[model samples]
Target: STWDSQGEFYESEGISKESVKLALKGSKMREELFDHYYAEGGEEAVSDDEMVKYLDDNYLRYKSISFAKTKASTDSSSSATDSSTDSADAANEEAKAKRDEFLEKAQGVSFDDFDSIIDEYNDYVASKKASDSSSAADSNSSASDSSTTSDDTSSVAESDTSSTASDDTSSVSDSTADSSTAASDTDSSADSSSSAPDPYANEKMMNYGTMDDSQKDTANGKILKEVSGMSTDVATAYEDDNAYYILIKGDVKDRDTEYAKDNHEDLLKEMKSDEFQKKLTSWVEKLDIKVNNKAIKRYTPKVVYDKQTEYYSKNNNS
Candidate 1:
């Protein structure tokens, strides 16, 4: 038995003296330990230097992080075992149950039904793109007009403020220059408008009505671009009670890709539009599905613990 600083006594499993030797030799066991630690910590997992120090300083803690959860499930659960693992299992099961229920409800749905939904979503995207483009064009036109107005006002002010004949002549010259500048600005705006790419190119929705049998087969089960205003990649469809989902696999435009990268969270939030979710909620409610929370909580990961701890004394030294 070993007594911790908390005055709690627990059964002691003696340290494995071969741990440091295995780690130094780059053994497969040590690699497995690193994998567990990485999985637990994700992108913020300890660096190589910090990992060595961590292994040396808290060898038992490292072992617990690696294998304690597995051991607890096989053996009886102890107060020392993390309770959060139970909650994680419950959450995962709840999500899975919801997805299963959704799948069940979606069964018997036809390809035409999926097509209609996708078409509606694509039309919405097209309308939004058109509105945005119009607004931008209007803004540019307004800015150009405002600049021209400013130049006209300045010319009138120079003529009003003039006292000498030379100043009056200068005012006339300024007015002529302003007219030329305004003309140049108009030409530039026209040139830019002509060069501008078609905003509707990426915004065009797929027409299911025009698709042939081969095209339909090719288009099915592909990833759709997020710019389509559809939140899900797959459209649920089934034939004769067999569920076969079709994925929207459309090419993503460069503009949409850049926008998604710049505003990832915002784009996601937009994708989960209130109207789309309300429809989803209505469909789920119609199914009258219910989940078993108790059953979900009962499903936890099987745990196994390793009794090897080679560096017990190494903890205090660090």
Candidate 2:
């Protein structure tokens, strides 16, 4: 149709009217004539066949431009997809790096150090017990001296008495001596009882520093697991002051004497501190744990044992 239209336009120009009519007579003949005309330069004196060839070449050029535009669009889409994929991969890698760093930090702690500290505390308790016993012994010696002086004073008073002074002095002196001896015996018994130190104090104090490395590792693992599994709200709450208080309680309770001597009101105040809870929650989060249903359902005996040991140690020291 385009070729016929071009032939009509050529005839209206009044040049080669006969050739244009012959060219349009058949499609095959027109195509062959157009090729032969195009072989020569497209000059002003060009034949109708040459003009048809020119128009067909222009059409091919337009098709090439369209094809180029389609190719560019496809390439752009592919590049965008690749960029998105690369970005996602980078983000995932960063997340993994963060997780690994947190795990490493948590795993670095040693429970053996904690145990050694507890041993030092136990030694301190033993020394304190010895000092208390010494003080008790000193007090008893002073009491004994005062009793002896009182017995001598009573004997002198009887010696200065009237008629039965000799008999009274002897009888009174004997009774006074007997009373003094009995008083000394009673004081000695009291002193001995007071000087005896608590048997469990040293043991309890020792527990504070006695955690094993394996136990600590296990605990660190558990903490990370828990943090990983926590919901946003619960995790936030865990990092608050309440959690810190629990850790402090666990720590202080490990020292038996300190726990016993510590005021209940003070403990309550510490427990209520927001900072303590926040510290605890932060610590737990730092563990970078992820807990699943299976881990929760199956109680880990080693963890339980460590916890119980910690509690016992705290209570003993307290």
TM-score of 1: 0.17
RMSD of 1: 32.1
Task: Assess candidate 2 and give its lDDT.
Answer: 0.31
CA lDDT scores, all candidates in order: 0.32, 0.31
Question: Candidate 2 regions off by >4 Å?
Answer: 1-109, 148-318
What tens digits encode model 2's per-residue C-alpha lDDT throughout 1-318?
544545434433333656555656765663344334332342223343433332222111000000000011223588886775675445444433432333333232232222233343235435545665677667666666677555553211111111111221101111122111111111122234576743222111111112244432443222322333433211111111111100001122223233323322232222223434465577778897877878555547665566556655755652
RMSD for all candidates, in order, please: 32.1, 50.2
The top-ranked prediction according to TM-score is 1
TM-score of 2: 0.16
Q: Model 1, 18-137: lDDT tens per residue?
A: 533454466565445434434335343434344333222311100000000111233246643456456444544443443344445434544223334334433543554566567766
